[model samples]
Target: MTQLAIDVPENIFSTLRLPPAEFAREMRIAAAVQWYAEQRVSQEKAAEIAGQSRIEFIDELRRRRIPAIQLDLDELEAELNDG
Candidate 1:
């Protein structure tokens, strides 16, 4: 378990329905996933950073319609060939 400090605007806080402590945890997970996406991190690694199991993270990615893999056409072709 980890602890963090956070503050939120009243309107946003109510809108998110976030309790103070849980808010920080959720925010950390959200930020971690976003940062990982911005940095182009691998799914497995991103899941770790988000503090969620890979299966859960992958499911969330699918639910969010975020691409699981960001591969160039050449890389995709090579991967397909290898497979």
Candidate 2:
């Protein structure tokens, strides 16, 4: 695993009420979620990046009100018409 170091303001930890380790974890999860939402990464890849299991990542998506399936209206319509 590659390790990354970021410089954050000291006060940010207190402001967010998160310690450095927890804050790093949250940052990872947030970045993974954003990438997943943007269609830049698959759910499996995003889960791996977030250090979460697939099921846990799906639950996180649900909690954040993000759709797990990335189907658009055209795809939905086509499926409906095919059925």
lDDT of 1 by residue, 1-83 (tens): 55555566867757888776667667756775676667567777878877789888877778767776678799999999999
Reference-based TM-score, model 2? 0.89
Off by over 4 Å in 2: 78-83
User: What digit string (tens of lDDT, one per residue) describes model 2 on residues 31-83?
Assistant: 99999999999999999999999999999999999999998999999999999
User: What's the lDDT for residue 7 in model 2?
Assistant: 93
- Candidate 2, 74: how far from true, in Å? 2.3
Worst 10 residues of 2 by lDDT: 63-72
Question: Against the true structure, candidate 1 has what lDDT?
Answer: 0.74
The Cα RMSD in angstroms, rounded to one decimal, for candidate 2 relative to the true structure is 1.5
